[model samples]
Target: MYVLGLGGSNHGFSACLLKDGHLESMIADERITRKKYGVGLGMRLAQGFSRNYCLDMEGICLEEVDKIVGNDLLVPTMYFRLQDKIQLINHHLAHAYSAYYPSGMDECAIIVMDGVGSKRKAGEEYEYESMTLYYAKNGKFDVIKKQYGYNLPGTDYVENSLGIFYAMITDIIGFGEHEEGKTMGLAPYGDKEFYEKIRKYIRYDNHANIEFNSSDIQEMLQLKEDVQAIKNQEEKERICQKIAWAGQQILEEIYVDIARYLQEETQCKNLCIAGGVALNSVANYKIHKKGFYDNIFITPASGDDGTAIGAAYYGYYH
Candidate 1:
């Protein structure tokens, strides 16, 4: 029963090996390639490099593996000779599985939220997943709801996502991309000056209020006052801190709102959370403090790295 899970097709790649349904080893592509998030050229080179590492961890060659699983992204053909040995599932489903299987709970509510995830076709084009909800029982989880981001018409930016809204503010404050943790860390130092202004843009509808949308982002939270041009040392720092605080506040408000709604709807006492946004310790703590669930489990590797674990679990169990 050797199952290998591979994740990080779009961002960072990781491999997780399971022997008889137990994790044997795992490694991320960025760990060996020194490439952050699998960015730039020759992604197959990095993925193949990571594949070898996991193979070595189990003291076995690729052919000896019984099964392999991955998320929505394509697995490099160089890594596996037979496509039949590999299976793929939705990005958010992988995220949910990663949280629930390890939570040691037979049933729980699963939530996945990230800046952007695997694309799905909508109308004439594709839209990326932003948030999702799932319910698990007897070691199997089913997606209950999914939220997608839509183009803001004539702009490259996609709106209607809480995760994107937070990440946007993080980038506007000059943190950029994976530096969203910095935004969360700086939130406490900021006052609620802009909190109300940002709240107006984010709204939701649907079961458990899972439908998240940014009513308007062209204003982009009234970002007309650029933080980059402020020359005053104290003034620049003050404005940035305030921006972080406001975004964090809005993030928690909506996060808890969804949690509360799910608690009432599912009546599930256990909660499992994963995805890039689940990395927010501040918002996570706020959810825990509110006592919406009897027990809550959050993966340490909540980002794409953990999706490998989820893929492996999904493959092994199926």
Candidate 2:
């Protein structure tokens, strides 16, 4: 059986081909198109297939694949040409499948957390979820819980997001977009008092829900402005490092708490993690050291790039 999986329409357009349950070829559209995240590389995805695998998208040749799966159902048809051949999979489900299927564990608790994903429920018009929990056994997965960014009672915007919070801190420290690792590296040089002050704003309950009000984000924004007022470059650098440290500390706290809560609730010794946040090696180590789970597996491509692999696996398994 030939199954082609596609992930695009948001960021990181990619394609993964699986032949009889084994990976044949996988390529991210960004690598070929030289587009950083492949944001709108939709119909052009076939170009990636043609370049990487010597395949073409012309009529009659496209039927070689028995099935095609894709992530993000709402991709614009104008940009995606394979609408008839593609089956849609939930964004977080793709993340979860990517982590758990390759862990080589028969049963494990899987966690998929990112900046944002498809809505919490289908066709509900609700805010997107930030994380999802699943239990995998016998090659089947079951969702245990889902957590989303806080949406005001009557509004469509989500104001509270740990992922965005971390990204904000990364930007405030002078790193460009997606340069969060630099902020993590600078955390050790900061003071504990700064972390204490920041912790008051970010809150997460035992249910794995993260809540932050406008006050929390507003205070951080003010600090971004305050850092610029310092006359000495050294002083500005010091303050930025402190902010990075405090933000990393908060991120680690929230991650560990969520892991602990999952372990307690699922009682599974094997754990799998994915998403952009899973790329935080410092926090991953902290979770491993906490010893909440005996075995913890994290996919190497934990970010959006791996969603293509997940889409393929979901199609193959189903």
Candidate 3:
């Protein structure tokens, strides 16, 4: 059976074609359109998900596909071509699946942490998910914990998120999207003591979920604006480096804590991690060194693009 998987189109999208449980092709949207993240489409467009390119690469039309799996909303009327053989996967759950299935483990503990996920209604209001923990065994998953934040819809900047906090610090240090690696590079040069400055403004729940107050929001802006006023270039760079160190250190601490909690709860020795935050090599190394699990798997394409793989697996198996 031919299965078409679509992901991203909102934040770095991609398309994948699966033929009888094998990957035929996977193409990133940015590679096709020359536009980063295929922005401004806002989850609607025929060309957004790169379905045409995916179909063409497989030497078949959309009708040839037996099933369609997706974690995003794009071109609904276009779905009529395939009938109702569609599966919509949840945002964070897609991340977890992307990690666990690729890990090649029979059973594992999964964690998904990112800036935002599909918005869900909470009482009278809606919020996006920031972190989710799962236990995967026997081809099934159980959501053990989830952390939702009041992330302002349509924007990446907001409080109450470690992922967003890192993004904010990256932006404050004069970096843009896809340039977070530069900030991570600066981490080793600065002192770990600076992390206390970042940590003071937030608290955590028993699940290691972060809760940032108004001061945390102000801190990034203050660092951004205040640093420019410095007279010496050395002083300015030092401050930026310090902020980068603090952000990276704080992220590593929480990730380790989460790993500890998962190990304690699941007693599963295999670990799989995904979502945008999993892209941090330094933090991943820290988690590895802490030795909470015997085997650790981190999806190389941990962002939204990797969800395509997860969606296809879901379509084929479930």
- lDDT against the true structure, per candidate, is 0.79, 0.76, 0.78
Look at candidate 2 and tell me the lDDT of residue 154.
Answer: 48
RMSD of 3: 2.9
RMSD of candidate 1 to the truth, in angstroms, is 2.6
- TM-score attained by model 1: 0.90
lDDT of 1 at 84: 66
Residue pairs with colliding backbones in model 1 are 160-213, 160-214
TM-score of each: 0.90, 0.87, 0.89
Predicted model with the maximum TM-score: 1
lDDT of 1: 0.79
How many clashing residue pairs appear in each of the predictions shown?
A: 2, 1, 1
Write the residue-wise lDDT of candidate 1 on 1-318 in tens digits. 888888775566778889999988888878887888766546365337667898897789988988888887544643455466778888888888888887889989988988777777789877887888888899866777777777666654565578778877887687867788999999989998877876766765534443334446666634735667678989888888988999899888888878887777788989999998899998999999999999999988799889989988998899
How many backbone clashes can be found in candidate 1? 2
Q: Which of the two candidates, 1 or 2, achieves a greater lDDT against the reference?
A: 1
Q: Sort by lDDT, best first: what order?
A: 1, 3, 2
TM-score: the better of candidates 1 and 3:
1
In model 1, state the lDDT of residue 249: 90
